[model samples]
Target: MPDLNWQKSSFSQQASSCLYLAAAPDGTVKLRESDNPDVILTTAPATLGALIRGIKAGEFDHIRTA
Candidate 1:
């Protein structure tokens, strides 16, 4: 894939690894982390939205560490 205009996540902390996202020219969504930009993950917008919603609903809370 060519270069994308990645935007940092608003919830990112100044001292923590940040999340970044961008929209590809083909309409698919691109995601990466500030700590590891070389590894990019692509997915459909709807799938990403669903993941966000699931996150908001505590669907993955079981995986949280103390």
Candidate 2:
């Protein structure tokens, strides 16, 4: 994770400031809010891709309400 470049989601608003990203060197994907960089959640490449697809397909719409 030496050269990892963390990027926030394009959909993240300035107010929310959530960080969502895919990291190289191991192809691991991670999600963490910009306000809290110390706490990161990681997932395998395949699962990460699937979750991204689900989000794009509106499978996580409940998150908006919660």
Worst 10 residues of 2 by lDDT: 15-24
TM-score of candidate 2 against the unseen true structure: 0.64
lDDT digits (tens) for residues 1-66 of candidate 2? 565677875677783577757476666776677777778888888997787799999997774443
lDDT tens digits by residue: candidate 1, 1-66: 788898886777762588889999999999887878899999999999999999999998886568
The runs of at least 3 residues in candidate 1 whose Cα sits more than 4 Å from the true structure, single-residue gaps closed, are: 63-66
User: How many steric overlaps does candidate 2 have?
Assistant: 0
Report how far off residue 16 is in candidate 2 (Å): 5.4
Off by over 4 Å in 2: 62-66
lDDT score, candidate 2, position 19: 72
